[model samples]
Target: MRANSAAAVLLLLACSAAATAEAGGGPAVAAMFVFGDSLVDAGNNNGLVTLAKADYSPYGVDFPSGATGRFCNGGTVADHLGELLGLPLIPPYNGRFSVGSSPFCGVNYASAGSGILGDSGKLFGALFPMERQIQNFQRTVEEMRARMGESTEEFLSRSLFLICAGSNDYINNYLLPLSDKPKAYSGAAYAKLLVRRFGIQLESLYWSGGRRFLIAGLGPLGCMPSQIGAGNSSGCVDATNRLAQLFNANLRSILRRLNDSLRDARFLYWDTYSTSSDVINNFSLYGFRYPHLACCGVGRERGKFACPPLLPLECGNRSEFIFWDPFHPTDAFNAIAARRAFDGRLQRRSPMNVRELVQLPLRHQ
Candidate 1:
């Protein structure tokens, strides 16, 4: 049953890709470089010795290739965005596609459990922090320079840098009972720290010739199944949501500052919190029957642990669920979010959306 559903979705995606290509004529941007955590991770964690991994079954039941290490059941938000941009799926930095040659369409440096802060996901073991991911991108730049020479600069400048991070910093670090972060800093202070660190990371990318950035703000972390389960709350936890809101506010201010100060750089922000809240609040309108429960997992709301390798039980209709596991959204939801981020209005994607961002004239340096 799941296989049939996956095949149907695959066919639909192929048709959509073909139609999108025919309409756009070609790829919208030179490439799309992705950075962030599990939400956009395209199997980077599969090579790492980490507890935070989703390389097994029931994980990618909806994807044609099956569990390729993406957290969703099928295509991730990044994968969908790549298709919408008329580009092929962006390969993970640690994967075989990135090993022998430079992917001109860009590479994904995101890893599961990674965060803005270096020590945010220390408990997960062997994950790439934002700084390390930037270092990896630097390596890619050097590779591109060797192959394309000075042309690499223009190539990257015209490309899009899509980033979606910061959830783990709060969920796995500051809010964890065993973590020391909560002890040392208040919620507001921690958010400020994250924003400052995030700014430095973006600057590092800018220095590396990246000019177009679409940074996704943290979603309502308090509304995730894990948070609800942890707090034993029937509804979203207000305190956790407040912390996320604080970080998002700071994130927007920093991006605006960067856009104003940096030359030839356009730092567009995506309001994931508000967008996600709307979807959850009006799940029926979006075809979601289980907005707050996991499609696959065990325990209360099936949000206690990550989906196990051997399926104890799984939802028959994955497309109807917003969440695939305890911590990640389903492929259906990923597609919706990607579409919104690609062409949403000012309220969702500030200043401009990805479509507009790609259309902006590149100022040669």
Candidate 2:
């Protein structure tokens, strides 16, 4: 069967989940600690002198603030996920409010070009690598301890820790020009390297009192508009996609091992690739009139660069496109993907969904 046909058949075989309501009067978890790349970034790079930012108009035109540093045209996956969990949209760690003043829902530490390795996204100029992001989280924990006093660990144990990095490691670092990583390590070898580093980061979060982890696997980076625009192939670049798969597979194995070792911890793997690929493959099913073309952006695939403050080429119906820019999905797509990862019973979220993870009993480490 053809690829689209195969996707349609799988769709029919898939199980659909109902909307999950928040637990009782408020969010099930005490808070949501987010860390990652642009996927979950919520204005963390707003004022930073970095080339990896999206704090301009047309980016958040559909959003209330007009432009809020989210790569998408409106709310992000983190925002939707938080809403479903009965928490207010988590603010960026670098936002106006300092540590203790942040809302109980938690703070977003994700930056647009961040990756698992400290060296990743260096070309972005001043981007927050994962190590630094983790450091920021450590500081946040300290602040929480100072504010919450003796109840800090107890409260944090009941919170959800969400991470969605790795894409930029491949897109911005490994595959970029003049990079020595690809030469030094094979794709599979590099994947193992990333897994090792990512494992360490999770261990750090665990040490800092995080027990519930919603770890999002990398999506099909080769299929993204940026890659498509740069490639000679008419279809999704298979090489890049293969690299992503290798990393994701290794990541799942690492998470399983961590879960086996950590008695009180619950590490839930969120399959970003499957849900996202399915939507991209069957655009009509998701109400996307154009899956390949971005809603905003200019140049090739509307993905050559970030959508500028004034891009006259932006699509009229932002909701009808799968992507807001060449690299990031539209807000509508983010919401759909977020919901699927949150409560869907399908393979998109394995072992248990984010809802199930949140509902798990909090236990001291």
lDDT of 2 at 108: 82
Full-model lDDT for every candidate: 0.82, 0.78
- Tens digit of lDDT per residue, candidate 1, span 1-365? 22322232233233333444553543347778899999999898998899988899878888988999999889999999898987777778787652223223667889999999988788989999899889888877766666557766766776789999999899888988888888899988998999999999999999999999999998888878887877667889999999999999999899889988898888988988888999999999999998789888877878898888986546888889988888899889989998998888744444468888887765543
**Candidate 2: where is the Cα deviation over 4 Å?**
1-27, 98-103, 346-351, 363-365
TM-score of every model?
Answer: 0.90, 0.89
**Per-residue error at 285 for model 2, in Å?**
1.0
TM-score of 2: 0.89
lDDT of 2 by residue, 1-365 (tens): 12322232222111100111234433257777889999889888887888887787777888887778899888999899988987756777776643233234576889988899887887778777788888777766665555456666766666789999999889888999888998999999999999999999998889888888989998888878888887666667889999999999998999889888986878888888898889989989888898777777666787676687764744788889888887898889988988997878634433468877777664542
Q: Among these predicted structures, which one has the highest TM-score?
A: 1
